[model samples]
Target chain A: MNTYDDVERTGMSTQDVEETGMSERAVLLDFPGADDLMAAGRVEPPSAQALARALAGIEAAVAAQEAGHAAGRKKGAVATAPLRGMSGRRRALVGLFTAAAVAAGVATYTNTGETPTGTRSETRADTASVFLNDISTVAATQSLSSGKYWKTHLTVGDSYLSKSMDFYVVNDGKAYKKGRQPDWQLGPKDLDWKALNQLTTDPAKLLQLLQTPPRPKSISPFDQALTLLGGSPASPKLRAGLFKAMAGLKGVTLVGTVKDSTGRSGTALEFAEAKSIGRVIVDPKTSSILEYTFTWTAGASKGKATHQTYLSVGFTDKIG
Target chain B: MKPDTRQHEERSDGAPSRDGGSDAQLTRSAAGDAAAFTPLVQAYSPALHGYFARRMPGAADDLLAEAWLQAFAARRTFDPSRGSARGWLFGVARNVLAQHLRRAGRQEAVPGVEITDPWQAVDQRLDAAALAPALRRALAELPVEEREVLLLVSWEQLTPAEAAAAVGIPAGTARSRLHRARGRLRDRLAPTGPAGRHLSVTGDMA
Candidate 1:
């Protein structure tokens, strides 16, 4: 009998016959009792554990922030905590930020429309604050300023991290390799460790370098790499610290509310970008973020992605 | 994942249970109705659990917990226009599973074991004993992809489209896989041994 004879026996449609032919070529294509297996197959959920860990972290941070607030109140040093960027850069113009908050606050901005304006901490000045403004002006005048430096602290979701920079405007300045000590090398090929080290130590020297461009022959590949990492991309969403660094005002954007593991209410916030995109889970009643995450993308190409690495950051109120 | 304890005062049959609307349900849940979400949990939990267990390690409880937590955390991003609430929950849980596996560094193919003797379960309703051994041998011999497609369809009862979704393959691929699998099963059960050398073209009783 012809192979076509079998296909035509049941008077089946041409499409059905073709489908059957394709499947017949592959062994084990049609499994029996697929329904029962699917019904029987079930997996336990893991969100509960993750949520618990996150809540513990949030509680610790909130408690710490409160204690610090209490201590600041006792010292009469303006109990308001300062706002910071993703990299923890404080606003150079605190007075302006405070004025904007006060204006919004006076207007009674609250739960209205899709997004609501919330309360902001009152502003105050310190040595670090004054230094930040100077650095801002330098950065503004020259994209790459010589001998300028700035040190700032940043908080992600609830956990805090630190960043420091000694800015130098090297017209042809070379970058140093990451994690290399200044005394480790010398010569024309080796960048001056003394000058490179100034960004981390001497703010005055850093500022001076910001004013003068470095010789082209002294530039290093390591320095070029650092510039690339710190450089801003085209996408606004990808710039984690851009708005806050430029505006000097950090604010929370409330997307909406969600229920948590304990059957309690919580708020969700989009706090990261494609490279580290994640949502912040916060206790709605307390207005405290219990946990957050940094999402990492992976793929063969730098831009295209195949998988993700979700790094969850749990916080406690005590650490804040 | 906190067991969604919200009490949904609605009936099934794909009908709206409340006079107010779905928005009211969301609002009430958002407003701290811990029990308001109970109906939703109960209804979708079985489906979610079943979906994951068939292919993975069968740790339904743990997977369900993760899925539920993900659904709750991402509730705000849930847009009603795209799909059903249950479907949205599934999407969220799927993402959670991907994250969980990545964190554990245990990304590998965990194939489901084939039931050689369906009668081993001793179910009085099914005469699986007659068909079990042949089915088992046939299944075990099939290629991994084919076996998976077959089991998910016949036993799991997932529609061809849904099965395709789970396996992360196209429905057309799943349909072709199922056909090949069935043909082999039919050939193996056609009674081609010693004394029973009679070919049963009926495609049963090997």
Candidate 2:
């Protein structure tokens, strides 16, 4: 377990406080649904089998655009919208963002190859574990920017509630403590950056670090790993380690390719809960999480289960 | 929250753009540069599919096609200054959903397969999982306005402003509504002194 405790937590910058007009902001108040909201709207990239269909649709869409373009050319449609990120306002926005912001994220205009290849790293690990590890690589490469806050959009796919939500952790030294559930609301109060900075890429050490101070007997190592992966602003190395650890946990098994509610297909990992089947769908190519779902494999809600589809996750310039 | 009569209009439909193709490409697409539009389609299709999938489940693919077709038909109307191309496309999706529901009439609320249990059944395996069923029920019980704002920010990852745009409300109104909704959720999720936390429900947003 790597603890950068030798380094004190970074304090909120004077500029951040003065500009954002916020101080002592602990738990994210505006963005709600840490539990219930995690289960919505992340579209998994097309699967290998669905590739042809998607391509065909893309062709049609392109053709439609072509037709529209031709029509516009014929009609001479003038550029009506704000003239291409060049306005004074856009410049101001661009100004607010320095090299730091550019380093922080790859803006859409500058990003390329956004589509998923539908290819997973060839690994004998649990396909799901491979997926988690793979996605960690994606995050690992992303640059972090110094900003007012760090945000995450995560989907929680539990038995009865499969949900998605956006979570924010300011530079303030507070994180969900390593103990109980409701207590997590009051969990370890420390600098999130410090803990994340202390994260070790080594899966074994990372796993041990995650269980620091120990957790309730009811909480399995799998649960703890998940808590960090889904909750913390962990480095990609840390996220990958968590996935590797998750693969080693009992009851975590490959469930094969599964289509999410949105009809996108990905490899799945399933673990049996007392009353339901806990499932995770992972995009093979990007290693990004597609969905989390818990279906009642038994009991009254047998046919009922909730799922959270993560729309997107990243460190962004804005919190909204 | 009481789910809306017209979900597309009533709920938060500010679907976040994944590929985030620039508005320029959309401009090109409108001008008939079909090639310029390919990336946009590739970028947006999966997310568009998800948008409908949550509402109509398996019908997501077909609805996605219809929405794109409609978008192509009205590509000229897209004004980047007013909003984003994705946001505009989502508005189109909302319209398509509305049209689909209007055609279905009384069956509007029943887009996906109907589950027998009004009470969604879920079993908690560990300490964290225990929170699910409890929150699910409480979520289902919230007012639609608050629920809409909450889900827009929390689930869709929309900024309050984006949620405002998607849900057709003032940004301030969206923020206030989100605040109230969060309050309700906080009361239900972390009750006073860890009382009976497991009560009851999130209506199927799907």
Candidate 3:
């Protein structure tokens, strides 16, 4: 029937069918077959194990449905989610790299613990060191379970650079998924969860490894400490070590309590850059990071800092 | 962050096809009949998977599961009189995709994955991939709405009406979009003297 026979069933005309066929041929040719995509996408055919997981999610659905019905049928009865807000600078950072590069932002690995030799500002003194050692102790007291992958969702509030279209274009910068909020995947690329847990809680080793590569050039050791310590799903011991290591950095100093743009209150740590002030907010209660904020300390973009908040960070049972 | 720029030369395939009578299976599934849902899943999963695979690679299965989960949870609301179960399912899938696209960023410059060059991995004709790269460029140039309709109709093998139902647009609008998209494609893919090889390929399609 030349595929035209199915027109009535498909609600399409003969010409529509032909054109669709032509165009569809182009799409289908891209993949070898269903299995090829399934493999690439890591999609398995509803195995027994998967069915169990589906059943669990389904149970949540049923309970939500029953609860909603009991409460007179809410519009949100479907029981799943997605979200947060957008920031321009956050978008630029996420947009600059591909999903693999951005999601796996810290994929670069360097086993060597050779600290880059540089000037150490003696002004940091013993006070900051003592305070940091104390915070790392608190970090060590945290008790959280391990998971498969570490996911972090963040948004940029304001433009990182001066809001100039020509400059933005010349920089060849991209504001990634401006409309769609994204959660970054941070494990399985350069380091695994086990390796992260096994690393000693020593500050020097933490600083040496993190200050390697695949990070933005503007990222200082303090910023590196924030990204690694704030963004990772590190174990309590490792987190403690990271906090201590960060404390040892010359420029990283505690800035006391602060509230994120979301109005969530947390202790703030600020890193002074030439033109910007980078801040990491840690939830004092859990010894976990809450946000990484950047404010323009000087220049045309001065006084404008964008805060990137962590929506959720956890270990999933498997890669999605 | 740059969008895809690779071109593909793929081997030809047979005519497009569809799976029908899913409405009955969907009705059966709603009645708590697990077996009834099996046939329906088997029949329609490919189209749904393909729908997501085109826009988001390596996410089809997860997205597909999310869609089905929504579909099954909301099965009681399915009104066959309004449209085909497959179309309704497509709508649910689109919702799931919207969520994923929101939750995760897209890979704009996905190589060997773009519609232009499916044959990049396949062992086939060396010159079969569009030499002019006009088709893909034209595709990129088409309006997002028009492109969605064209893709649904062409890529998903949905009739204009079904595509409309899937995307929640009117059937007439989808038809117009389909027509406009085809016209734009024709304009861009039109024969040029030096692109005779591509001409033969697209001409065969025409």
Name the top lDDT candidate: 3
Name the candidate that leads on TM-score: 2
How are the candidates ranked when ordered by DockQ, highest leading? 2, 3, 1
Q: Using TM-score as the measure, what is the rank order of every candidate, best first?
A: 2, 3, 1
TM-score of each: 0.31, 0.38, 0.35
For DockQ, candidate 1 versus 3, the one ahead is: 3
What class would a CAPRI assessor give candidate 2's docking?
incorrect
Across residues A173-272, which tens digit of lDDT does each residue of candidate 1 receive? 3422234222211113233323333322122322233223334523222222122112211111111112113122222233334554444454443432
Off by over 4 Å in 2: A1-33, A39-55, A61-320, B1-21, B106-131, B193-206
Candidate 2 residue A91 C-alpha distance from true site, Å:
27
How well does candidate 2 score on lDDT at residue A312? 55
**Model 3's lDDT to the true fold?**
0.49
Q: Tell me how many clashing residue pairs each candidate has.
A: 99, 37, 12
Candidate 2 structure, TM-score to reference: 0.38
